[model samples]
Target chain A: MQTEEEFRDFILNGHLYYIPHVTIDCAIFGYHAQQLKLLLIKHRNIDNWSLPGGYIKRAEKLLDAANRNIKDRTGIDNLFLQQFKTFGDPDRIQFDKFDKKKWLEDTGLPSWEGNWLINQTISVGFYAITDFSKTRLQTDFITEACAWFDINNLPPLEYDHDEMVQEAMHTMRLHLYHYPIGLNMLPEKFTLSEIHALYETLLGKKLDVSNFPKKLLALRLLKKLDEKRSIGAHRSPHLYSFDKEMYALALKEGLVLS
Target chain B: MQTEEEFRDFILNGHLYYIPHVTIDCAIFGYHAQQLKLLLIKHRNIDNWSLPGGYIKRAEKLLDAANRNIKDRTGIDNLFLQQFKTFGDPDRIQFDKFDKKKWLEDTGLPSWEGNWLINQTISVGFYAITDFSKTRLQTDFITEACAWFDINNLPPLEYDHDEMVQEAMHTMRLHLYHYPIGLNMLPEKFTLSEIHALYETLLGKKLDVSNFPKKLLALRLLKKLDEKRSIGAHRSPHLYSFDKEMYALALKEGLVLS
Candidate 1:
């Protein structure tokens, strides 16, 4: 709880050196157009792709680091962020082959005496759901370009990032059983078919529409709107929004079958 | 993939030592008779009370560390172990008074340079549900006495260990909604009244005996046995053991009545 001037002085001096060793990486996944997508960035160092990550500064909290990561990469803050797990296996990184030592020597940067440039990385994994259409993407110093890729056709990610992405997806699937995950993926005022399609994609199968609506209606977690969809066949389907309170109660007490 | 000798040498005298910084702390809990109980240890360091925990070895996984912790303290290896969460706040340790400098000076140990001693202490929270009858507790180098205390009355614990216990209890309560937790807490071949009493304690309320039996029977997760309890003045009650597959299914799909 030091003052601004004191904090500035501490940062300038070596007493409060920011531990650049710790970094926060996020596995941002969203459903769009009936497909699961992951946010990724191509790194400049090894020309390999990876999830958007940033180093944790000394003053910031772990969740703050996650927020900064999401902001730095996609310019989207205050989304549904949850810490899934931490990756701390010694073989999590292969920096020896990356030639980080040579790069440091070439740059004339003083050698890091601590576990800064070693295999002692403790990465905190955060799973986020964002409005992909509203994201303002930015490519920082380490990355070349950032984009969203369909999870099915993802390229080989650098380090153990692919494993992290898989873990995040697994957590998302577990949460999706109760929560309305499609609401985050789809735009506002979506049709019944649109929501159904997203659910089908996540479940990875075709479900009978007759039984599906009956089950969803029984739960009463959705609100049928007056407005109908402008596209599709002559008889357009009505739009629906999630009944927040009912869904929350359903999450707590769990959905009941008719 | 390395040979046995090579792997041994790598771990023992490795280039950069992979110190097992991670630890598992178990707040073994049980509700007996009418009072809740918590397992704790009197630490040798500064004569403080601490949770039973130890440094995780390089060879074992996180779950192995928890099992090892429980085995080291209680001399009982076969117990229920569940990984609830990991606590990793950077300032989680008291650094100002008993800082890293004091710790290094006190130990008079070797470099231990690779060990992230003071900077970060990420602990995995695990809890065990034991009958309290089977435990043969032991003391280690840093532990003086291992004993169980009434949950309502607990001694001050070291290093946010109290919060960790509360977290374990929170997880147990969440699990109770789906699965039966007091099964291990009670003795084998427990009476129906005893089972109901344990559930009442866990639920923190006295349930109607009539409705309780009906609802519990409907779940079909328990198997009624012919053995009768031969104790107390009341009529001998029937005994029951949980059906493993049925219990697991009920746990996955929560048996909610509301």
Candidate 2:
């Protein structure tokens, strides 16, 4: 197996024997303030907001490229990055009749010879749910600003990124129905109501509070804490944390929380 | 959007372009007599067999390519062709230093000049569940024979196909937990016991028939027919067919029956 450093070197070497037209972009999703959020960057030239993305180096896997793009721009490497789907539409990168030759000319980047542009781009999208508090945002030379946007009110995204985000949301919707996803988006300990609130946010609707507790308890994926919230006007609710082992075991046994 | 013919022409054009180097391969899983079945095609040169697969035509979607491959080989299209996962290991095709360039050269097929060889091979894997009786299998010039082997006793497959099958199984396992999948693999209308038997064949173990009916019935994804099983040593059992509306709705809701 190639070491991480060796892999990075191999990818950045800029060899010509292989096609170098491919790029990997990540739709890093996070649940924050009771809304779905996506990390976006303002490019210097495009003048449009887009997902934090970059090219896949030669030595790295497509997933590795996504992780590298996330960490290189955000200083967070351990985020859960799972590949969702591939965007392989032939016209996916048709930025206004800009063919391969024109693309190279416009970018002023090194023109990779060989059917570099003819090699169709199969973009492997990844969804990363990260602890927003721990992220240290960093902007690359090509980018001007970086921030998170509420998914409900997204800015105009460049290229096929909007479509990518839509696909990710569809996948997330499916995930929320089967697995508790926003647990990482919450604090270390959270109230039952708060947990329910997160689910509501993800599902984009209300859930039956009466039967939810029984269902969750039956699943036994969470551990109730002794502490209770004291500040809110509503009644104090007990807090809970996910039991990783039990959750893993339950999923293995074909038990889904939702 | 380009016309289908135009798209086909673009893909067939001699100009080597940077289109995504993606291949669509199907696991083509079937269940028979409490045993998992995998459809395999014998390769041209070696003793090894492979899952029916094809390269993603430039104009063709990955899922379409997989379906087209299955149809070309088995004369079965318009079935459940689900896009399960996309594999993009940079060296996934590398076995015994047999890289893409070397393989292309060995094929002795017309080669095009471009970085297309170096382009990432993102394979979109789909699993098609079809009744073995309904299939009319055919072999291409590149293939020597086609057969369905018990998945439990699979022959060594070429490339990363074995891993691909495992991934498909994992996806199927998830589907089995919440949805009725073997409907396509079984006769038009099957007895409840036959359906349960099919599940046993898929899960590779016996299940509590009593509780199994409760879950299956509760899901309401199947419809009981007025007719009964035609042939059996014992008393004929009530037959059932998949409820199309309920199945579509359940699929949309991501509800697994198991």
Candidate 3:
């Protein structure tokens, strides 16, 4: 929603153009310099931090809706987004902070309870990893501010978002074993040590350095390039790049790496 | 809906008591004696096989709604259920098989185009594995028949259910590696050979018997019982049982089994 009129229309008639009772929340993980961050937005009226999310358009597919929300916030395209879990507790949206009276006063609306926006909702949660340094965070009329927060230092979030983050983290960590990552988050050609560090950082633990690279290489998802990077007098590490076909296959059919 | 009045009320005013545009579909995979099957329900109005599913009540949690649907159809409780995926394609429900005219004629309902049930829907897909021999299939007013069909020999299903089954199967297979299973699917005391066979049947492929049991044992999720089951004089084999504590822990915190 762009203007007050659009917001009012959406609050009243969004059910006509958007699928009511179902929304999408995104956990955008950012990785850079071996540190992970999460993108959070401050709602304009509510003044609370939350995962960036929005309603699905009537004609849009679920993935398309998730992708649109991602693009609208991060100003980055082509990040690999995934649905982690859906939250649908009957009281999930109940909070004193909703403040229907405040909403009516702020928007010049006549009533609030019967509005399409005030119903029980079930939210589909999606998560994606992108290079933090590459994204330009954007905000909309309803979102006052958007920024990246260190994952471990996130403030108390609104509604059931804390639970959503925990589940997203769990699913994303499990997925690190099954799906190939670092497509856009890593350098085009990198050494084994670099990729090993990437996995260690994403998994948020110490992976056996000896075993991590070997497992990646064993998957045959990486192709060794003849070029080598010389870091010092006697150390030249061989660089490798992802084999596009194999990487795609791993993404689709999944792989086992532990 | 149990009667014509209830069905008519649901068609016209279900949005008042149900979450509009959201439904739940279950892929009930039944396993027994090295055979795998799926529980399917033939819709009375459409006269086509479909994964048993229903709308979520306004006051119900997602899992409770799923459990209610499962128990209503199969008379089984406490089976392990997992959410595989949520499907939301605009044309996913636009099948010619819905037969609005037939629904109106059969139920004495009014025009259906603007009915809440006629809107585009997003379905949360869940899957559960249960022993087929134990469940007593039950049918409600809308369900003409409920039965198990061999997984490999299933008839064409209705309304994006084929896609739901495919996704559910893929997730369930991947989960076998991450989560503990075979609590109800296997006997209380089973041999290594028997457990291995269960995995092979569920996976629909042969596992390295030598490695499969060893990997499972390495997780320490099972215990070796003192007694052995004697078949022939020299063919007796030691039996094993699940360490309930360890199995529950593994179920909560996923472990790498493959």
The segments of candidate 1 whose C-alpha lies over 4 angstroms from its true place after superposition are A1-23, A45-48, A94-115, A178-183, A188-193, A203-239, A243-258, B1-24, B27-38, B42-50, B54-60, B74-80, B94-120, B127-131, B149-159, B166-258
lDDT of 2 at A181: 63
Interface RMSD of 2: 2.9
Predicted candidate 1 versus true structure: per-residue lDDT over A161-201, tens digit per residue: 98898878765554555455555776677777877787777
List candidate 3 stretches off by more than 4 Å. Answer: A2-5, A107-111, B1-9, B95-97, B107-113
lDDT at B69 for candidate 3? 76
Instruction: DockQ each candidate and list the results.
Output: 0.13, 0.36, 0.79
Q: Model 2 chain A: which ten-residue window has the lowest total lDDT?
A: A1-10
Candidate 2 stretches greater than 4 Å from native: A1-21, A45-48, A95-119, A177-183, A226-236, A247-254, B1-20, B32-34, B72-75, B97-120, B177-183, B203-220, B226-236, B249-253, B256-258
Docking class of 2: acceptable
Q: Candidate 1 at residue B118, lDDT?
A: 42
**Clashes in model 1: which pairs?**
none
> Could you tell me the lDDT of residue A213 within candidate 2?
65
Each model's total of backbone clashes? 0, 17, 0
Local accuracy of candidate 2 as per-residue lDDT tens digits, A1-258: 113443234334644433354567788876766766789988655656888876666567777778877877766686767666777776787745535544444544334445343345667788877655567787754466888888788998877889899877767666655565655777888878777878787777788997676777777878998888776688787888888887676544445555
